[model samples]
Target: MRNGFAKTDDLIKMFNVSPGTITNMIKQLKTEGLVIHQPYKDVKLTEKGREIAIQAVRRRRIVE
Candidate 1:
């Protein structure tokens, strides 16, 4: 399994958003302490973010 972060460029492509939009979202996430980002580097999920993501997936599965 891949255990590393996705690059900012990869996320921008994945989300089909503009670079500016991604930058804004990253800033928001960082502000919320949900992610850690650096310019020209990968965006990483904080522990809080990871937990929330996992819970969201689990909830989706349960609902499905």
Candidate 2:
């Protein structure tokens, strides 16, 4: 994202998913050490997460 961080509400709206889904997803990411979430704030990707994201985007472009 342009801001490099995503709030829970934004994630829910962007993914068209429920709040519970975002909460669970965030929890998983946190457990995996892929994201840093601040209570009542936004979630920022860790370096490892950013690398994975870049790889995914590159793979998508190549596949497409």
Candidate 3:
């Protein structure tokens, strides 16, 4: 969700991860109801996903 509804290709490029890896991650996130993918569009976060992302940011700040 950090890329503001990023596409698979965009995420792969941004993180330098393999397409297969991204696919698996996306699949898991979707299964967990943390992400939603629209046809021909980027993947967006569900409310739960956003909350988790926000908390992760806060945690990172605290740790840093």
How well is each residue in 1-64 modelled by candidate 1, as lDDT tens digits? Answer: 1465878888888899999999999999999999988988788899998999899999999999
Displacement of residue 23 (Cα, Å) in model 2 is 0.4
* lDDT of candidates 1 onward, in order: 0.88, 0.92, 0.86
Over 1-64, each residue of candidate 2 has an lDDT whose tens digit, in order, gives 5489888898999999999999999999999999999778899999999999899999999999
Query: Candidate 3 lDDT (Cα, whole model)?
Result: 0.86
lDDT of 3 by residue, 9-59 (tens): 888898899988988888899999999985456888899999999999999
Q: Please report the candidate that would top TM-score against the real structure.
A: 2
TM for every model, in the order presented, reads 0.86, 0.91, 0.85
Give candidate 1 regions above 4 Å deviation: none
Candidates arranged by lDDT, highest first? 2, 1, 3
CA displacement after TM-score superposition, residue 40 of candidate 3 (Å): 5.3
